[model samples]
Target chain A: MNEPPRLGDLVFTPEEVQKRVKEVGRCISGDYVGKKPVLVVILRGAVYFAVDLTRELSIPFDIDFMSLSPFRPGLQRVEIEMDVDIPLAGKDVLIIEDIIDTGLTVNFLVRTLEKRFPRGIRVCSFLSCPARRIAEVHVHYFCFEIPDVYVVGYGLDFQGYFRNLTGVYTLYDPTGRSTQILKAMGKGGKR
Target chain B: MGDFSIITISREVESLGDEIALRLAKKLAFEIIDREGWVALLREWNTELPVEPPLEEKEQEEWMVTVRTFLREKAEKRGFILLGRGGQRILEGLDSAFHILVVAPIEIRIQRIAEKYNQDRATASRILAEQDMQRERFLMRNFGIDWKNPLYYNLVLNTSFYHIEEAYTLIIEAMRRATNKVPSVPVKQRSLFEEKNFLKERVFFSHPSEEDFARILDFYGIRWLYEPRTFPLVWDEEGNVVEAFAPDFYLPDFDLFIELTTQKQKLTWKKNKKVRRLKELYPDVKIKIIYARDYEHIVRKFGGRK
Candidate 1:
């Protein structure tokens, strides 16, 4: 068995996350003032951020969840593990994302939503690394712009662990923390 | 391949037909002939053909015919589970052949493509659309058949609603039934009876649980109307219906209605009251509520929610 990965440096404290979430919420509330927008939160990664952001918003809105697949061709096609139950046609939809890395998956999601003919669609990401983006995406709302690094915690995971952690941390030594976790779990290697 | 000879599985992108076919083949211990396998066979049959992809339009047409002919010959000798490569068209009239088409909505396919590539949904969707168009054209050029024509298939499965396991079992049952038919008689002799045309104006379910309910009805060979009729339980002062209940599924074969609710019991109290009134008003109607706890058990046992 492979060792579990570890976190390195604290990138965003829980307080920082809470603060940024409020700011984004305020901005969204102002932008879609009278409109009852559907907040489509990308699952797993953005779930924590989405919940906090929803609370910060004073305006009445509906909440929905979507889980997206990692992109690949052939056997691994882009798939939505879960879809929002609410009808999206002609509705204002705000996509909440945890992090925008390559901007590939997010771009795909936006296009997918567009086919449903929503009145308008905007993106709000908790974290983004513009330097590493391969696909072009315009994020309307963002919290922290961090450097390209392995980040985990607060719903982000290194091999499905550390998602329970309260704060965001970069894994400078990928092998270090993973090894320790694996040792504790009585295992070792990739994940 | 026990007794059933040839199985042709057609599918749209991201429908998970390939996975279901693989599992079915394994269960039956049949020789699987997927796209790559067909390509390999094509190479062995004639060294002149291009082994690499991106074949010219003319080459692709030629390849389809050659592969179809090859599969026909192979099926004549023994059984095989053929995946794609227009097997449905080629094996159409074969007595022992079973043709299945698996499909899901475009949105679901886009999501699957995105996940597989770990790429953006836009790129994944574009590729799927392109691939579908290519497949459509390929079939039209080669066999003059629409890829989605339900008439060409013995079974059309919506994998979006049916889990792989449920799908596999359905195929097994269908194949078993197919095998029991007289050897010389065509499987198409079986009455379609609300099969192909059933999808016209079909409702797109908002939840996987509802989809699963539909899948079960389909697996049992039952005809169902999705939220077809609304039953009014309360009326407004102006003689207008104030409250009504639309059950998730109405089974025509059994004359039964099914309501699937994953909502908490307390949350559904009002809805339950309306259903009770609906029952009282229409005493002939039979309704069943699949509550959250029972629904979870079904999901746990069947593995469809995944």
Candidate 2:
């Protein structure tokens, strides 16, 4: 008989995030040197990460965004309820996102994009918190691995008001509320 | 609870518009004023009426003649929550009744059709489209107006996303607001014939009851031409003409004025002002009546006021 292990503490400060983005950018540049990769960023939440991630890659790229509002708060669903379409058929596609927490929203995006039949599909997320990651999701590249604490900021919003923040920061408020915020923000979490 | 009694649901479809309607006969209150029943009634009305029924009973005859006298009598005495037949227009003069239009978005309606008939979404969409066409045709033929226009209805509800129970709650609320119940007109049944005829004139007739006003001229054998008050006038306190029910119905033959009253409620000061304004705008036509209960009978039956 064995007891399940408790989540241990982990941290990746602001500087560490920039260094990871540079590395991710290098890998993206090397991978798609001559090809045009269409980057589809989901709106309201992923604006910041998509911008930073695209900045790192030095290849010819076209950018588009899809906005959805299914799991706004107090709900858990495995579908992106609403989205504006992006041209994806026969073209190589890259879905750049902010974070992958519960992975439901991301999974829906993957399934939906698969239906459209892109030439190739890949996901690049800025942060990955695997302890909370749900099954059936694959993020091809990610920035840093950190212990699961609900974090916000860096274009990620808390109630859509805080996305203006330039960099990521942890909640100094109730950890439970932070978790609630995470579950809420987890709507568009990684994939 | 009773269907025949023109049941006003206290809850929504989720709470059981269908369930209540289906259960009504067993519950034995009245006939279910549901879709099939409503369609049957409409079909029967369509069977009796000419392609387009007249506004006044006089304007309609032969096939166009409806349960005219009965509509007058039952309107004052009946208790049914008249579903979708333009029945509201027929019973417009009555003050104690509740006239409501139950509406849902295309998605919810599509979903319900799919679930009810156990058909595919596309099939359901097609069916809904057909029903909508049938309804539009019926309204055009019967009321001489567009059914989707909210002005003709006492209440316009968005039932698409609402829980059936929430929808029912709204209907119940309408019953209350209607207690102040702006003395609404009864609903009439719509048919397809009026639709084709209206198209000949190049007018979009959406309300079933409104068809009465439009076909008034043709039915009466009167050479007068009338147009629906497609655009309503926004008015002031006094009954002075200041706005528009604009581009009034043009009746070049009779040199008479005719106004369309979708329902039978008294012309409010605001509405009166608009009507007066319209009258002033077109002085060529001299008549100044709602034709709420006139001229139509003559067109249908070639007779006097019903």
**Which candidate's TM-score is highest?**
1
- Which candidate gets the maximum lDDT versus the true structure? 1
Residue lDDT tens for model 2, B63-107:
233444444344345444445556554444345434455566666
User: Tens-digit lDDT track for model 2 on A1-191?
Assistant: 65422221113445666777889989998999999988888765677777777788889898887754432223322235455366788888888877775454566577578667799889888777675542247899888654445455665544344455555665333334334444554422221
Q: After superposition, how far is residue A142 of candidate 2 from its true place, in Å?
A: 1.0
Q: What is the Å distance of residue B32 in model 1 from its true position?
A: 56
Q: What is the interface RMSD of each candidate, in Å?
A: 17.8, 31.8
Instruction: Please identify model 2 stretches exceeding 4 Å from their true place.
Output: A1-13, A72-85, A173-191, B1-306
Tens digits of per-residue lDDT for model 1 on B1-306? 235678989898779988998898787767888878878877887778654322223444555556556667777676788887778765566666788999998778878888888867656755675566556545533443456878888789998789999999888887777675644755342122223234424568878888765554443234455665566566544334467687887554345677888898779997788788877866667777777755653433223111
Q: Assess candidate 1 and give its lDDT.
A: 0.69
Off by over 4 Å in 1: A71-74, A174-191, B1-306
Task: Give the true-contact fraction for every prediction, in order.
Answer: 0.00, 0.00
DockQ of 2: 0.00
Worst ten in a row by lDDT for model 2 chain A = A3-12
